[model samples]
Target: MSKRARLLAALVVVMTVFVGAPADADRGISVPAFYTPPSSLPSENGALIRSEPLPLALSLPGLDGPLPGRATRIMYKSTDNNGRPVAVTGAYLEPTAAWKGPGKRPLVVLAPGTMGQGDHCSTSLALQRGLILGIGVTQSTVSIGYEVLAAYRLLAKGIAVVQTDYVGLGTTDRLHTYVDRVDEGHAVLDAARAARALTGTTSDVGLYGYSQGGGATSSAAELQASYAPDVPLKATYSGAPPADLLDTTTAIDGTELVGAIGWAVNGFVQSDPSLKPLLDKYLSDAGRAALKDLSTMCVGDAIFAYANKKTSSWTTTGQSIADVLRSEPVARAYIDGQRIGTTKPAGIVRVATGVNDNLVPHPQARTMAANWCGLGGDVVYVPVDNVKTPSPLLNHFGPLLSDQGTAVDWLAARLAGTPATSNCGALPGQ
Candidate 1:
């Protein structure tokens, strides 16, 4: 077996041992009814559609314990890439501890990374359940617990947290629009607006996310000024963001996390129906089957199932999907639309990436920061120290663990209204 395959096999064993045999099979599982929007959605975006108080136990599922906060699940009005109205679901948690900050209590919008394409993969559901395991054989519940733990950290600091599941991930029956710049940004910004309307707590906002969430947070930062001008965005912390899709998709191919490519393809086709025929002409039977299966899987399951599986195997001409992307005009257009750094964020933005990150590619991340800086945006570029590991996955994941504390502190400082120092001039190769 190849190195990536061996790593995947080991991961399966570890997950099985730690998570245990998919318990109860139905304990915290429920099909969301509100995922489907009404035929005539309200023209106004960011309007609160509905809300209910989340039980305390489900609010905090960290290993240490539940957080001191009140959780509420909210369905809010948002917009699709075409400016059509849509309904997005998210969780709002108000810490019991009083706000010690200057001006009203601050709200931190937490955009979760790639969880899965299924509805059961909802972050709000995971937050409410406290510990998210397995809903069925189709779902992998590995990272839900960690996600809640991360949110708990913000809650502990007396900063209210609002987690957006992104469009279609948890609430919609349609395929989740993974990595679509506008859709993800709209979901995040709308979540902030919905939280402000529903809670009436604060106007100050901070955006935090890594990996896929990082991309969303970065997109949200750029869109905040034009999309939701009323929302006061304080700071944005984006870690390992896939700011440039053309580079990111090429880097992810043939890696353990290659399944993300499939998610991106599905999202692109779903957003623009015209792209469907273009993809169909290139995709092979194997590719179709793989995408079909991947659509139902969470990140954990996808990593294992498609590890080291090249996109070339999915094409009729035996050409890699990356090659097709470059050669095909329709594919190129769709991908180009997803690129970030075209607009500067309204507030100070901090970007972090592992020096040896293999999943999203370190150089592209540097380019993103540089592009933002060149646009006269205030940016703090942090290249995490490299990890000594033979496994490529570890090279990508180690930074997320090592840099968590620093990211938390940086965001906390932003929430505290501390002036951020721009290191654009100091960025490598600048």
Candidate 2:
């Protein structure tokens, strides 16, 4: 086999060994009982409903090591896009090691990137189980991806990390809201509040994420001022944020990550009930089957299942989802509402993107940075110019490894209360 083919085979094998079976499997795949919330949720947002200590052995899965702190699984109250009460699940890690830094120990709200649309794909579960692979045979495999490692790095710094599963992914039976800005932002901020209640520390907070989590962190930065003003957000590090869904969806379609389009559509149906009928009207039988299959998948499975699958194949009119978005008023409206950077993040914000990232076009990221800077937001825009591989997928994944340490250091400085210098004034192509 060719080098690329060998690499792909190795990845598939590794993922298969680690992930083992679909999340719906009768054994091996464990979904916590807390995943089932009470019939009626509490009215208060960020209220801690329950908590359980997770031993360190299970806490640092895939890290090949132990964490610096104790981990707690928490089911907390949060609001959905419509501000309705909902239950969210996440893991809060409090370092056993003491913070040697100045002021109170810092808390970092770590928003994870796209895992999948299934509840079993929860980041909290992945952290505890040490597997980042998703459900199904085609996507089965073990891979330790960025989010957990980043959380581990932050924990090593004596900073508490609260990794949210976002709304619906961990607790609710409903579909995860995916990239819906309001739900994602609310979930991130509220996770912070819930973390404070669990840890009883009012430490300065920082937000960090990439890809889908990046969008959440960026949205949290914008919503923190109005939604949860009391939660002092010190800084935000958003890597390859999908600031414009309209542009991003178009770019992602027909790519290896086309499954994400199905995820997004599932989210839209969940968030806006009216969209379901519209989808039913426009989607072909194949499209309906694809969505159902996609719903069970994590990111890895989705990528394998829908790799380079044309969106046009799923639609009744043979139009790509991106084209349908432009033509369909309801879909367009819902997608438009997910666009980020409308409000300035109330603190220093660092936005980074891989120049060669084919999944999330770098130009859109630049536009987002420029928009924030124009609105007087302190922005540090870093474009990852190094391309480790010729493949678009590798270009997107390479920067996560290359820049992880730098991203951590940036967050550390912000948590240390050091003033951040802006590169907005020197942003290229501005």
Tens digits of per-residue lDDT, candidate 1, 164-189, equal: 88888776547789989999999999
Against the hidden reference, what TM-scores do the models get? 0.89, 0.90
Q: Give the runs in model 1 whose Cα sits over 4 Å from its true position.
A: 1-30, 56-66, 130-143
Worst 10 residues of 1 by lDDT: 11-20
Supply the TM-score for candidate 2.
0.90
lDDT agreement with native, every candidate: 0.79, 0.80
lDDT of 2 by residue, 10-86 (tens): 33333322445634542225466878888877777788988998643233222323435678898888988886888
Q: What lDDT does model 1 reach?
A: 0.79
- List, in order, the clash count of every candidate structure: 3, 7
Pairs of colliding residues, candidate 2: 14-142, 15-140, 15-141, 15-142, 16-140, 16-141, 61-130
